[model samples]
Target: MDEIEVEAVDTLDPGVARDTAEYVLYGGKGGVGKTTMAAATALASANDGTATLVVSTDPAHSLSDTLEFDVPSRPARVREDAPLWAVEIDPDDALSQAGMFGQDGGFAGGLDSLLGGAAGDTAEDAAMMPGADEAAAMQLLLEYMDDERFDRVVVDTAPTGHTLRLLELPEVMDSMVGRLMQLRDRLGGMMEGLSGMFGGDDDATEEDQFGDLDAVKERVQRLRAVLTDPTRTDFRVVLVPEEMSVLEAQRLTDRLDEFGVPVGTVVVNRVMEPLADAVDVPDEAFVEPNPEGCEFCSRRWDVQQAALAEAQDLFREYDVKRVPLLADEVRGEQPLRVVAACLD
Candidate 1:
């Protein structure tokens, strides 16, 4: 495979900017610094005077700690610019408001009860209800897409498995139907009237016979346009300098191509570059505190450089950013700004 190398930027030029990035999503393997990177991107958007919401979809939320402030499960202001907001969406709320065939009657409460008759064949076998999270998260994104209030929506997403499902949802909606409730609703409502008015043609197909929400399908297609359009939505994948992380990022790019979601960039976080004019490591031996009990940070960096070579080989068509390791935990505005500078 061909390879092209890249250095992380301090400020990205408009030449590489997405023309209509109303929605941007960050996804990759767990523990790859996606939350911090996504927060920085959203912060930059806000600094540019666009109203932006950076939402965390990771089951283990890091946004509250990252911002060094309280972020509500609902959307809340995290800083000075009225333009920027932070939220960690409640997955339960997304399902209830998703209006699943109106079975829940659009009530924000009581979705589990409402899902009574809607649970299909595979739901029972799904481990810890994986499919439910996909539905709920997609519903949340769809709800936001329908609303005109927010200028930009930046998602700090769950890991690749569920995140892929969330992005491909609108494309796959055509197949999600066991039965088209919209079709049945229309045909049942005016069956007798339409049959008489249109002259009971014997060879008519179901689509020809339907009259309700002919416009609705088009609307869903339009929504799909925003998600799949290259210049509109950018999917950024986060990776580290490790074997599995590099391989996973390569696989995810293939999947995104299959689903037709454009990848704007690849963010490779936590690099340990040799110093040009700065303080060196105090000792040659491994001697740092292991907060998560990961004692070999230098060894991790060695593995990462090899992985970075692999990433460069895999994503030659796209931009790959290398974010250096931070001295302290990346919390609050200062660290986030540091990261934003690295994304250029």
Candidate 2:
């Protein structure tokens, strides 16, 4: 495969730049290049002099491989030349360290003693809920958003199913927290009576436990607000040039709309374009693939064209960008720069 030498442009075209949002999230079906797109965008933004952090919420992390940087569990600079940082969040670790259910079972044991173990079990069950890992990962994302070290945060979210569940987590967690708080309120007198009987200082401990719950509720509200605010966030759906990918992107878009999260960009990755048209070159500088001579190329191009048509119509109202299928894997800064230029 012949490689095209992509020249470095001093500035991204203003009209094509979508880096205005403080938080940009790329999400779609699995293996559709969301990580590549997110890495490219973060690199571009950082090159443009913005302090950018690229975060991977997907359990199957690929940011490290895509950027060719050893990304840590916590945010760290990926490139010395550019203001770029990256982190592949470990959700389980985060959850364990979050103190959500209290440290060393102190609060949990207290709750159990107060309510005959039912309250503790309920709290533990909530913490181990279906989307608990995602919730933990999202909490880390929220913290990064507020971090003063970076001006912009690009998120490579999990695939469609996990992404949708992550979006729903704020409301689900908020409701759960509210119920727990209410329960605490109703059991206040009972807890006090029991504490006096056992000669334990349960009042202060219970107050502290409920305080943590209040803090979590506040953060959930803030996350929801940031997601819905168009100026602050942009949820970009990435997909490949295939019928199934297109349909999945559409479904993701619909769900994002339902969540009131701003969706302004749709990135169609791996679109089969003419080799000559895919890269920057002078007229007749590169030989174009003769689809007529290659039946497989011709058939694949036809399929891509059909999918592109449907995607264009489905995402007509949004800013749709197409990334031509490249001859090489998009790894390291150079390839990421090429992908970013294509994005422009």
Candidate 3:
């Protein structure tokens, strides 16, 4: 992680090896190639004969589109006998199972009864609040992490803002669960007292009522630990060669650092060709037939050059991988393998 000068290349270098990290999370601004990077990495891992599961936590769920395969909530193989699997998490289903409307019918149902059947809108609103999708996605990730099915997990996260919020969820949820547990205990104590006086069983059964809350709290703690552990987890950022993209990447890099997550590499996607350097001709002779032949390409190439330079300066301390803009859309395993080759 030294400050090294990075020059935009036509292809990507083999940055971080997949087997080394149990969980690799790719995150950045939307349309910055996060899904593409994740797909390529997973494809490479599968080619290496390692079992890999690529999970899409982004609600938009474009991993299916990128892979040109139908990805279900449960892991499905991308090809016959392939070691690769992919899934777009069903967020709403995950939330319902783990949220207040869970099997226990615990908090939400209780509120509905307490409010004399006026809890419909309130319960819906609770689910719509921020972090709901993150919590649900976390639950899905935890299940995969605990399963012995995949050797490694690659996460294609949501956009920058949503991804940051998701990363912060563990801490926020832990505190909230702790307070709720405390209140449940207090209520259980009073219930036990009343039951004893009413000649009911003296056993304190109410303590078991908060089992769902305890389960959620435990899962959050485990995920938090894994995320902060540098050896097991690495956060790789993806971005386009643009001023705004670089600034957002800088902010994400700083925030991940503050959260104790290790960022191994930054992938600068869709880098324009070095128009001047790539052409082998005299400056004067290259005029009309040059890369600046068209007005649009000329303006774009100029902007891209400045943004690329800025990215190098801003992320000098991290490994930077550049992916060229392909004329053909990157889709399916074959296309992803081409990208994987660039990454290699």
Candidate 4:
């Protein structure tokens, strides 16, 4: 076994590792079965009778597809063993919600409407500006992660870059944001002040009443504490049995360590095996994934298996898990249930 995988395996809970973590963060490179795994894990937890919320933060969303449910703000109950709610948080919706808190013509609303709408998408202006989506989601998450909400949250994060952006934001307030802390609430309204600061006369909107610079700072701190508190957030990295996934997993490990989030384990998915050719098959090339007939199909299976075993060996230093590739995509309760059973 590789050193990294060894370390990761060591972190395994003797019995679910239940107390060590409350919220679980699943993230990795794009297209590595993360969404499926996150949904399945949430399903498992919810089945165990804990109130669970499975959330997707990825811009290029696939949670709905994976769950086979229309999860567009409509929290679908995937399992009845317990109360399980799933939400695909739309960043645009968050921005609109944030706008309601701003004074009429307030900087928060104008900026929010601007960010969540056209300007956020028009690559002609600049593709990176939609970063506000990440911020907006983080903002809402921070504001709502208190004791009143769900019991445990399962966060399906975006691809590497965007996930890193979210990680970086928690510390922004503690950095050099003294001016932000000085802004007032109630009598001292920054959003309202911002609208007028830009030389416009307008009263604050309903949404503005909920927002305060101090509240924002506090919110960031709360979220940072929630996610970074080692005992609260358990960060799991997912990868497929391929060179690119392995490379990305290693870097993700470094980033998690750097950010102070606890590393849980790595999941290696989609390792295929040899199939019998209808005509002539090698005696040694017998494996259950049995075969999708391509010219070099057997060799392809060998290479994939080799890569996966190599990953297991290479990342032995951390917790490493192997999941055979499913012949069909897993969607909805039945498939998710199958995955949970496999994990068991």
Best by lDDT: 2
- Report the number of clashing residue pairs per model: 2, 0, 0, 25
Model 3 Cα lDDT, one tens digit per residue, 35-85: 999999997887777888999988888898899998998899997766889
lDDT of the structure predicted as candidate 2: 0.76
- Per-residue lDDT value at 197 in model 1: 21
Question: Which TM-score value belongs to model 1?
Answer: 0.72
Query: How large is the C-alpha RMSD of every model relative to the true structure?
Result: 8.8, 5.7, 7.5, 8.2
> Of the pair 2 and 4, which is ahead by TM-score?
2
Candidate 2 lDDT, 1-344, residue by residue in tens:
22222223333332224478999999999999999999999998988889999999888888989998889999999878879999999977766655553323244345556677657545574554445456667878888999999999999999899998888878777766776677768777554433332233445575555566678789989999999999899999999989999999999999899999999889988866533443443334222445678988777767777888888889999988877666678898766776786676
lDDT of 3: 0.71
Please state the error at residue 83 of candidate 1 in Å. Answer: 1.3
Sorted by TM-score (best first), the order is 2, 3, 4, 1
Q: How many residue-pair clashes does candidate 3 contain?
A: 0
lDDT of every model, 2 decimals: 0.64, 0.76, 0.71, 0.62
lDDT of 1 at 265: 90
Clashing residue pairs for model 3: none
